[model samples]
Target: MCTIELCTIVLVMSDAPRLRHQVCFALYSASKAATAVYRPVLEDLGLTYPQYLVMLVLWEQEPRSVRDLGAELGLDSGTLSPLLKRLEAMGLVERRRSAEDERRVDVVLTDAGTALSARAQAVPQRLADAAGLSPDEIGQLHATLGKLTAALNSSL
Candidate 1:
């Protein structure tokens, strides 16, 4: 007869929950690595990763309400406000109160911001090259992450 000690089983099971095995940690680490890769590339364009994301959203559709931007970006007023302010200071975007609603603020891209879209167009391919991932692999990764995000959000 073979017998495994109860203490040995408990110790082994505990190791399963270690940081190396955590999905959250893996995602967190990967996000940090991706941002690090974007740092220098974005620096040349005078934008941070978060700012770039905001610009990307605006590039897709401009003159968005602060509330709309917040929801799309998954950011609250506190974080989005400062980012908008900074972009405004850089002459990249402008914020104004809606004529119909004094409480609503709309964010619109400046001419410079629109022109910057041309320069920023190369960022995606550059980032993919930096990560050494082909387009197919990047697409797969993006799809998998989308599913993961949906699963996690649904759970919450």
Candidate 2:
């Protein structure tokens, strides 16, 4: 079969939606594809996509509380703690009691993690090149996805 024929499925019943016609499936599939594109590049930098996301926040600002990080990343302590532990073991970050609030724990990037930021500087352009999306196209997609996410989240 040709590529389009192989990729597409049509249903006679209009009421029953096809998986291929699902926005959720498209988003899920695209998210996986984006992660696959990041996998090798992230591996080269000794990072997983989740770890990279954590680093991205810390790179922008330091000493973020675990609660704040969890809120920002939409992760719970159960999930975030292990990832933080792994990054800590990697010598990329440290978790410590917040100076301002003893009850809160803050995450700080180590010197190594700070340095990794420079090495990872080219990742965005590399991914854009790999995905073959122009900057304008990327921005538009980002905006659309952001709006979709917000709308979906608000409905919940």
List residue ranges in candidate 1 displaced over 4 A. 1-16
TM per candidate: 0.89, 0.89
Estimate, for each residue in 18-135, the C-alpha lDDT of model 2 and write its tens digit.
Answer: 8999999999998898899888889999999999999999999988999999989999999999999999999999999977889999999999999999989988877798778889
Angstrom error of the Cα, residue 148, model 1: value is 1.0
What ranges in model 2 sit over 4 Å off? 1-14
RMSD of each: 3.0, 6.5
Cα lDDT for residue 7, model 2? 48
